[model samples]
Target: MMISRKLVYVASLSLGLSLLASTAMAKVEMNAMCFMKQSESTAHAFNPTKEEIADSSILKKNPTNVTDADVDAKFRIASLSKVITTDWAIAKLGPEYRFKTKIYVTPGTKAGNCNLHIEGDMDPYMGREMLTRIFTQLKPKLTAQSCKYIETFSYDQYFPVYLDAMKHQTNHDLGWEDPARYFNSTKTKNDLAAFLKVKSGLKGDFSNIGVVTKDRYQEYLKGVPSKVYSVKSRPLFMIAKDMNKYSYNYPPNVLFEKLGGAEAYKKFAADRLKLDGEDVEMYNGSGYPAMIDGKKMYNLVSCSALVHIMQDLDKTLEAYKGTRKFQMADVMAVGGPGESYSTFKGLYAGGTYDNTMVAKTGSADKAITFGGMLSTADGDMYFAVLTSPETYGGADTTKARVIIRELVQTLAERQKLKKFEYKQIGDMNATDDQSTLVEEPKQTPAGSLK
Candidate 1:
């Protein structure tokens, strides 16, 4: 009996040390060498496109939850919202709805000496470079039209939504962090001008918003004078292209308005998806400008829903080639013989690099998300991940992104990670078979963001 007990103790101790040593080895390889091994993590996501062949290997575990779809916050996803906005806009307005900065001249307007009431619909065009290009292309037209001189100019964001105080009540408002002013598209009208009055200042429906206050926009625009020069945005598809490629913000905000109706955000996604769910719902279309009461926190869903949305729209998982709106590829940035910032190669900036990736990444407050199709050597696979902290992490962005990157790569080359017995690991999704392996688990955690 004593000898049997001793043998059992020795086996348990050996297994425990082996697990610790494996995790340590994985971490050390990353710092000491150019390679990184899986941390013996057994987490995985169900690849709907592939069959899971039952097999057993040296089952390892990831230090972090890489294959878990834990997104559940309704915070500002920043640029990530741009793609969804773009997707909806293209579907609604078609490719003809060019988001251009139209230089409308009320029959007679000039360059220097005329009533240049600069106008914008709060559209996602009117960028500095776009303005320069438009001017360059229309220079001959302007010259032929006999443009005259003007001493001063006044600009106005025609759409009053640009004047909104962000339903959110964070102090980030006073700063230039508002998506309206932060991105290239959807810049404030008269943004080029150093001095101009904000035409759309007050909300029309200041009181109860359940109806009663119709024609709100016309009421708001009633103050603008008759003579107005306008600029149309680039094609909606073009703007959408930029939004998706670079993850712009204000562009997506404007999109929710264009696709879901002007004031529809008051109803949130219910007005868009028009479907009820087992999870919480949201009122803001872009999910950014949520009210402060935390009422929108329940808005959540599974990766499968997102996949269906894309499929229904025919946003297929195909590579983007040719002269794309944006282009990105990796190049070796040398520090010392291979001591670079992220040797994974290339600037993480968005673009149609080789036209092989169609994805979106999201981050706001304490939440981070990434969803899309990666055209890997093995083939294409759709992945979505969400991380919601109890509170937003103000400064530790690196930690969040690192986690996102780990999740992305883990799903990208799942074969690299060994498999283990499935256990009740999280709060999102679980099934009857506790020992069955899963590729991706849907769970929510109250982890500290910092």
Candidate 2:
């Protein structure tokens, strides 16, 4: 008896599906084993529920604690908060937004002495090199005036106020121990002054350098004096990249203050991302809040909430990519086996998973978290994992890295079994591979400037 063509096609389809199901079952088992190893009753682990970005379908999840790993359970995200802060900044401030510092000269009665006023716009990355650049631009003007000594160097008073606010907001008491030293404004100012003195052959030392009073500051803003030059910060993405790559606390804290603090950022996230307010709690943008009663009061965000935020951020980034050279990978830290600014750089670099993982890592006394995107041959998957203090016994970054590596490997293997190609979000290759070796450039010393 001759079988119909339709019957033959149906038979082939049945066999294909059976093989697919068998492979999927094997993946589930592997994920379960991986989760069990981490779950060992010692740590509370919130593993990833991998999904296809194209269709938002769950590709794989830990089989053991599917119910325990409540997607909405709040976990302290530590430095992972940088991811949210950076994305919010990109959305609200725009990726190209540059902080500005306006320079003004109040001509002095003394031939060699002049008062130099620096009106800061909170350029977080303002540093010695940037100062050199700004001063170089101002050198010709200073020479034209025959300026020899900077008798008085003043900055916007708001700079210190903002820094103080960050200290208070993050409950960083250590920030005040030597506000002058910690802020490093005085040193920066001295450095700038020294740089100018040497460059211009000035004789006298920079005598009076401090914050401008409100009354005096107003006059300068009204164009009473000569405006000399202005220097702009690097693009916001560059700053955000450093914030995530090194888990730097100050940049995000400053950004948080610019947004009007914790409550403000929460409202912004809720309204813009459509996230539930209760699911997202942030006391500071840096995710390094003061501890209370032996527990950290860091930012709290659910794994599910974080994953959703990442998805929304990816969409925003994709939209921006159409008009400019911007992508989420351009801002967030890349992990897994490369000379990149990754928390896991030394541990995972040149390993089996090298160049496949891009993530932000967070660690506080009470928790450690990892959230970002993982790229596989099938596609990119956004994920978040939270390990509680009670579970891990403390913030064990080494353990966290190991688990995250295993988790990513499991998801990649699972994706292989499904044979589903996920749409890539951004260029995974666009990373600063050298960031692993060198530390992020320190901000201009705020105290030194004072």
Candidate 3:
């Protein structure tokens, strides 16, 4: 009996030791690094600096251990994909670009009827608020013009669906639908009716919403013997600011699709940054898990690559042709007291990071990533951190964030950190659609000072 008991104790002790060994070996894999602008250069040139606690295996192409990776190692960068998407938008579209929707109206041969043609520019943010404002303006004009009923309403499919979705608060997942076939003509007509009934204050039914293609619309435009009214969306930077502030998945994907989708962005990065294909792979702008060819794809980027991209984006923002100078926070969420609804609200709030960090954060089932600029007295320091745990969930995200907080603390301790000079735009949900009537610019005074 004593010998049997001794054998059982020995087995239990061995099993415990084995478990401990495995637990010790299973560390979180990560790659975190930063780059600071050279102090003396007029052109902001970055000097790469290592400030991470990672495993040595991180340098290898396929990292076995999770702990030690260098800046060059690749990892899934979740919401950080928004940062890259914003970079592409600013480069391709410029800062002042606005999505415009053209409205053409021709008085019908009969009384109290008019044909309305709306050409949508695929403006992603054309939601309920914008439509309401648009209709409010249109209603007064149409009433003054003596048109009671819209005899023939012609428009692209997306505009009506956007109107319906925004009015009903049903556009929760904007990226999942095929834009070309999202809504039928019948549904679009009904949606337009519902919208006009509630918001437009127009009398009589608006029948027949023709879902016309762009080519067909161009032909129609040539036949129209009347003026065109245009409504312009808010500038791209403001739209991007709200997108990153809340880390909404829809806007980035919409803007990305407009810029030519994920593959195009991958090629853009490769061409512009001279990055190796192995270093960066973007499946979507939102960094959401998507299946292509029956395989799940995620955005993967090296810390070094992300930091370099940030440097590029910053330079672009500084040179933006806007009335006010733009900074990283103009398009990226900033950490602070006022940014209560931003992505960094809970994670980076308080004196340590308040108004000092402008970044994008990403979290998935097994990945947690963050990258952005940290304002310091030395100069702006850009960083990217990617983490993959053995098992990750909501709790794991918290743990990863705690680690990130500590890392930021360590970095802050080393530098004379200062607050970034930018103000938050507050909550995204409360924001109104700031679209405006596109009017011809007034001529400047002959002797106006330049």
How many residue pairs collide in each prediction? 36, 19, 5
Over 1-450, each residue of candidate 2 has an lDDT whose tens digit, in order, gives 112324322533233234434434222111111121111212123334534222111223222253344556676777888888887888888887877666766566676556677777666555444555566556566666777666777777434222222232234333223222323456555655555556534445465556776467766546444544565666777677766665667667667666676777777877887776667988767777644577647677776667767766666766774346665666776543343334544333312333455567766655666666655444455677665533332223334444444454444444431112222222222123221212123232222111
Off by over 4 Å in 3: 1-28, 31-70, 157-193, 203-210, 293-295, 390-392, 428-434, 438-450
TM-score of 3: 0.75
For all candidates in order, the CA lDDT equals 0.35, 0.54, 0.63
| Segments in model 1 whose C-alpha atoms lie over 4 Å from true places | 1-79, 101-114, 117-121, 131-176, 180-192, 195-232, 260-274, 277-302, 313-356, 375-380, 389-403, 414-450
Top lDDT: which candidate number? 3
Candidate numbers, best TM-score first, in rank order: 3, 2, 1
Error of 2 at 116 (Å): 1.1
The Cα error of candidate 1 at residue 369, in Å, is 1.3
Query: What is candidate 1's lDDT per residue for 293-376, written digit by digit as tens?
Result: 744332244444343333322332123232332111110111111221211222222121123334565556544555554444
The parts of candidate 2 lying over 4 Å away from their true place are 1-69, 158-207, 213-216, 220-223, 291-296, 321-323, 335-338, 347-356, 376-380, 390-397, 416-450
TM-score of every candidate relative to the true structure? 0.48, 0.66, 0.75
